[model samples]
Target: MTTRDALQTQLEQGIAALGLHLPADAVPRLLDYQALLERWNAAYNLTAVRDPAEMVTRHLLDSLAILPYVQGRTLADLGTGPGLPGIVLAIAAPGREILLVDSNGKKVRFLREAIRALKLDGVRAVQSRVEDVEGQYDCVTARAFASLADMLGWGGHLLAPDGIWLAMKGKRPDDELAGIPAGFGLRGTHELAVPGLSAERHLLVLGHA
Candidate 1:
């Protein structure tokens, strides 16, 4: 079997462990997304993970691990570098609309291509800074975008009042959370171990309180 096949097997086991049913059809789309990401990375510096095998765990599964906790009518991904959680979520959870925003033109271009290539009808890629975004979404998600405080200061505006902000981070974000200004309350924090990944991962859910 190819290395990619091994990775897919590992990812499938991880999904099974989570007790979530990933439809058989979604596998091909995830692979397509990985291919697009590898193609774009060659020219646009879209992502560091090149091998499809690594992409499954580092990019696809890692992003999808937070799928169960997302709460929003619509989701907006801020600084959506190569459409990490945004595109991944749109594929995993059909029916929900996803707006993926990034300031980098090259990244946004790649995002648009990935969306088109995947034939994901629920996703819209936009080129804009999070701070300058005008509309509100039911939920806002950011990964490796900025510090929690800075993210709250800018990305917070993009979230609806009742919406939650899903922040994916490494290690415990206690120090960063301490820096956030008053008003936002921590709804819940959970450690997620990505299948095929040994690193520390946590998903922080914050709400306006």
Candidate 2:
């Protein structure tokens, strides 16, 4: 298989399974982003998934799994290290204005390069703590290592009154459910089926209570 066929086919199959409608160029551009990330990983150590095939499953497909939950015309990805769902979302579904926020200088550097290399328009990266981030967005996303309460506590204000928050979590975060602060209420909990990925994944949908 050619380089494209090797992982691109896998990604295409995964996308098909997820039933996401992406642009014709979306798959190619997604692979381009993956290649760029692989190159940067050697020096910057952007992500831990070192194997390219694993990258396709864990990074690209994992991000695309939540496309259905994303809403509105604008998005901000909090603690977007190397632009996981933000960059992936920008490629798969363009037109929305995107902000990728990360406190790590190295990851931000990789993100800026990915933006330019991918020619991802309407996407910007800012190096700031989520709480320090300014402006509101129609949608907000976070891949959780933090509990629901802490994540919302830091970036809750960034969500517009009518907006949705797509919080990606591994396994069901039942323990953290009760910790969801007062203002935000759980909208839905989705069990994500990621092709070739065995890890449990869930997307917590939250909105203003």
Candidate 3:
């Protein structure tokens, strides 16, 4: 039963049906980052879902269903193409400090070869373009990229000052939450049930109004 033991038995029954209490080496480093993103999506198509059991329900349980609203100590995924949920929340929260950001270039060269083959540490990819990325960041993720007022008008100075911007999305946009843009607000909108995914997921959760 090896294909990383059938994707670690479908990521341990979808993290025990999303009660989620990860880190028993986070399901073998999320099945070794889904076998290095399905061996670099067979030469950099990065992701079109390409079945590794639909990359475990559309890329690792739709990127760990926002892993319990990820807080603090640096994050910053912004258009992180291949590294959804910023390399699956830096492989299930290995003490924060993620920073993926992407401008393409073969999906930032497969996110720096899956953060150097998942040794992962604090993690870091950066090809730039999230409005020329710089610093600040207690948290800030993005997934269907633009349109939360153009993703907080392009990375909203990389979040900090009580950060938090999560955003992955699918349905419930409500006109991108009424075009949020006066500093920012709407700190709630969750609705994810990924497990084997039925589609129509959401996350939203913004901050700093």
Candidate 4:
């Protein structure tokens, strides 16, 4: 199979099995992101997932796994290093507004290029600290940003009063949960069984209960 074909197969089985729908069109968009990541990594160090196939499973599939639980018309990806769940979700969801925020200028530059190259609609790349952005979002999704407490402390102001926080973690984050800020309540948690890869994944939802 071609490299893209293999990755698509993996995404189909892995993500679809989890009830996450990634259509055929998403494959090329992901391929475009992988290619851009590779090109930018030479200068910006976008992501560590070097091989394209690995990018499909580890980066693309892992990001798309959160689709089922992401219920929002607008989302802010805090500390979106090279745009994980944010950019991928932008492509998958189409009409949703996605704002990818990062402190690093190079990564934001790469994200902007990826957005343009992929022709993603309703997506914006903001080069600023998470705390610096002044806007409300229906949801704030992040992958490997910081501790759950820190994430709430920094991105809490950006979330609308009714907004939810979708934080992705590897393994159950007991310590981080224990460190959650006083007011932000934990609504629920979902253990994601990603296909074609062996890794523990969890999504924590925080909101006013």
lDDT of 1 by residue, 1-209 (tens): 87667766877787787667776677667877887788779887788887777788889889989999887679999988999899988888877789999999999998988888888888898898788888888888988788889998887777788999999998978888787757787888999988888999999998887
Candidate 1 stretches with Cα past 4 Å from truth are none
Q: Return whichever of 2 and 4 wins on lDDT.
A: 2
Give the backbone clash total of model 3: 0
lDDT of 3 by residue, 10-85 (tens): 8889988988887778788888888888887897788887878888888888888788898898888888888888
Task: State every prediction's TM-score relative to the real structure.
Answer: 0.94, 0.98, 0.34, 0.94
Taking the tens digit of each residue's C-alpha lDDT, what string does model 4 give over 1-209? 98667766776676667776666687677777877887788777778778877877888888888888888788999988998989888877788888999999888888898889899889999999888898999999989789998889888988888999999999989887788888889999999877667889999999854
Number of clashing residue pairs, candidate 1: 0
Tell me, what's the RMSD of every candidate?
Answer: 1.4, 0.8, 13.9, 1.5
Per-residue error (Å), model 1, residue 81: 0.4
Cα distance off (Å), candidate 1, residue 196: 1.2
Task: Highest lDDT: give the candidate number.
Answer: 2
Output the better candidate (2/3) by TM-score: 2
Candidate 4: 10-residue stretch with minimal lDDT:
15-24
Candidate 4, superposed: residue stretches over 4 Å from native: none
Deviating ranges (above 4 Å) for candidate 2? none
Greater lDDT among 2 and 3 belongs to 2
Cα lDDT of model 2 by residue, 40-108, tens digit: 999889998899899999999999999988889999999899898999999988999999999999999
Q: 70, model 4: CA deviation in Å?
A: 0.5
Which candidate ranks first by TM-score, i.e. highest? 2
- Model 2 residue 159 distance off true place after TM-score fit, in angstroms: 0.4
Kindly report which residue pairs in candidate 2 clash with one another.
Answer: none
